[model samples]
Target: MRSLLVTGGAGFIGANFVRLWARERPADRITVLDALTYAGNRANLANVKAELVVGDIRDEALVDQLLASREVDTIVHFAAESHVDRSISGPDAFVETNVVGTHALLKAARRAWLGDGARRPHRFHHISTDEVYGTLGPEDPPFTETTPYAPNSPYSASKAASDHLVRAYHHTFGLETTTSNCSNNYGPFQFPEKLIPLFLLNALEGRPLPIYGDGMQVRDWLHVEDHCRGIMAVIDRGRPGETYNIGGGAELPNLVVIDTLCRAIDDAFAADPSLTRRFPDAPAARGLPTASLKTFVADRPGHDRRYAIDCSKARDELGYAPRHDFASGFAQTVAWYLANEPWWRAIRDGSYRAAA
Candidate 1:
């Protein structure tokens, strides 16, 4: 995999992957094509030196042109409408971007490499989510590579459709493809919609930390950097037409995770009590910890109770293992948001909001 095309490289995981891959493999040239939606930030790639194309994945002409013009040997597809709550509110964008957009990329790839024999290793690595496997019971084992996809929400359902499409293209047309279903990812450059970033921002600002249902939904949290390494591993060593589960082994309930965050926030505040002034609306922090701000909110509809990954295939086959433990990773993540205030503050100020 030399010349590469990374779709959605402006987003959280994609941006991290782009920066990491560039740093690690300086010889390779990466071209990124992103639609730059609400969560997609150009600032995420501030330091990343690569050819950035602001276009939709569904644009067949653009997809084909980039693949062929750049002699792209690998396509690391990360473009998708990925927020579950946003999907619950409006699902059309999910289907359009996740399902139809994937189809467009696959078609373009098939056409781009129809009879070209120059490219030695042509690969399409589709990034996916564990939500495609639906919720798991408390006693049920974690989802393996072979877990049947039973997506519960519009987001996961759309992603499952895209996964199936990739599989079909690989089998029917012999497109070299590998898919990975990963657990929850949290780290730098993440938008405020996700659990960790949202809660972290709210806690830091002394706002009410909303907990859905009992806040007991279990998720295997993978740091964005670890997830990127797992992805690179699959692209380098994975067998074509196979699926891999990339898990962090950091399984924790939502409530417990938030408690950890609370402690981290408290620690940060204990060091500097004047930090509360950053948020104009935040209550004064005499010595109060953020955990006291917890407030229960109505649970989301069709909310999965648990989502975990086995990831043995990735560990044994690709020699992949997550480096970040939950405790330290969680702390580092909090510290990143604390230090990168300008990054998140722009989003908080409505600079990246979708146009009317």
Candidate 2:
């Protein structure tokens, strides 16, 4: 935890992690390696000060250069092609970045950390998603670390492959590594593609809030801050070769989340009345509630019915538990978006679909 090379550090969770680290670990030297794709916005990291290296994770020369030059003791690998909808549309980029790019990172880290007998004690922490366990039946228990990998979509399959590579590096090559499969994360600096921010911004602008299928697809919604804390717990105290499931303990279907978010926006809007002028087109400003914008669309192919994580290992072993309850976190999230309209507007207004 002395010097860190954080890949995808300009993206959602990575940016949040980098910002938190800069504040909490001011003594640590943190460098960000990001391709600055549509998802990886430099503005996400604008408020914080960190060394930013603009490059792709698959660039072996660049990865190796940073590893050697920085003497990085830890690598928090968050670089991946993560949007499920995009993966459904174009799986090639997902395979290339998630699988091939991860391999490049593992190879570079292994050579630099373990090869030539330098034997520098190091850590490679992979951030993954619970979707790798596939969808669960209504009655099935939450996925645990031992849950079989049953990825349902191209996105999850690619991530599953990367998870395996990290484990293989630890077992075969003896690279010190840890991984955490987290649930849905919603908080500040999130690009407006995923559900929360997308819905919030869309509803704010009077656009249709598209719900896949019946809007009943269940997700375990973990606040981004909580997810970041869980990752830090794993990086600080996790045993090598172990996988931890990080969850926020807030499980609900998509429709319920939308209703909650809409109401939160309503309250936030009432408090900050000027939002009527900011997102002036919002239906709520015209006496129509934000939730009226809901419109169900064809579901994603192979949409997971439900996802839950059994993170008891993280709780019992790593002393981890979510601090913000769903209500508080959700309220704060809506409020943050209300306050930071310009930040997301810059992203939402453009063709921000370029892959990271």
Candidate 3:
């Protein structure tokens, strides 16, 4: 069996990718390494059969040991401190995990897979975000692979630093590397801190749905499954040292997405009488309804106004096509949250927080 190492395989997108890949390639030996940080919940990988290694990526000895002993031939790195608000509050962890951790992983990979800068059939695939392109105006075209790096927040800055390191290793030490910057991903297993899940969970709980600024911030939404498919495509067939931009082409303003979620939640509850009684304290109970719960909040510091992606490169090169549009993806995601209350309730009730 081909041995594969997946870093941050317990987090949202990472966990989804792990589950999908495990099912698709059942014979492949999959090893997962995660720090189990506040956002990295092992429960997200409950259905996956990969060998779990609960540890930080910065642990050089552990990483090196895993690579050498496990005979890991391919590394798909998804580990990082990804929250923009949290990054603003605590930039130190972001730098440590995103920049330093990436460096440590590259160093360990070099030692384990190379001898005097010689080539290996093995590969390193770095997963990143389009926020590294910085903010765009309303009229600006979507970002492409060649867009200049102009990261606006600590989170994006850290990712940019990691991207640079990956490129340097590929060029200087001849490491076979490919990097992909994807648009925002929404689907099951996403933590509630993000916009989509946050609103969904809050709407269900009858809590205030906070909308930052005027809620006009534009973002491209890709289903986690589609994003995972794009990553696998890059792993299987992408050119070394090249960057691919993966997007679902479902771009919309934040307010629009919020409204859509409100409608979906209302319809879901209306369809199922059991949900109405299960969430008795919900806004639907107070007659305020999901749409009435929306409350605009102050904008975050250094908030990017727009982020769009030009995914033609991925489509042309990898034959990548997203299967779910925002409507279908959002419906499925909201339904997942409704069906799996225990998964997110633990996250909200301080149980997971205490463990972290």
Q: State the C-alpha lDDT per candidate.
A: 0.90, 0.91, 0.92
Spell out the clash pairs found in candidate 3.
none
How do the residues 278-330 of candidate 2 rate in per-residue lDDT, one tens digit apiece?
Answer: 77789888767888898989987899999998999999999999998888998
Worst 10-residue lDDT window, candidate 2: 347-356
Q: Which ten residues in a row have the lowest lDDT in candidate 3?
A: 280-289
What stretches of model 1 exceed 4 Å from their correct place?
115-120, 277-284, 352-356
Most accurate candidate by lDDT: 3
> Mind giving the per-residue lDDT tens digits that candidate 1 earns over 101-158?
9999999998887556533459999999999999999999999988888999999999
lDDT, residue 149, candidate 2: 94
Quote each prediction's TM-score: 0.96, 0.97, 0.97
lDDT of 1 at 72: 95
Residue 100 CA displacement from its true place in model 3, Å: 0.1
Off by over 4 Å in 3: 116-118, 353-356
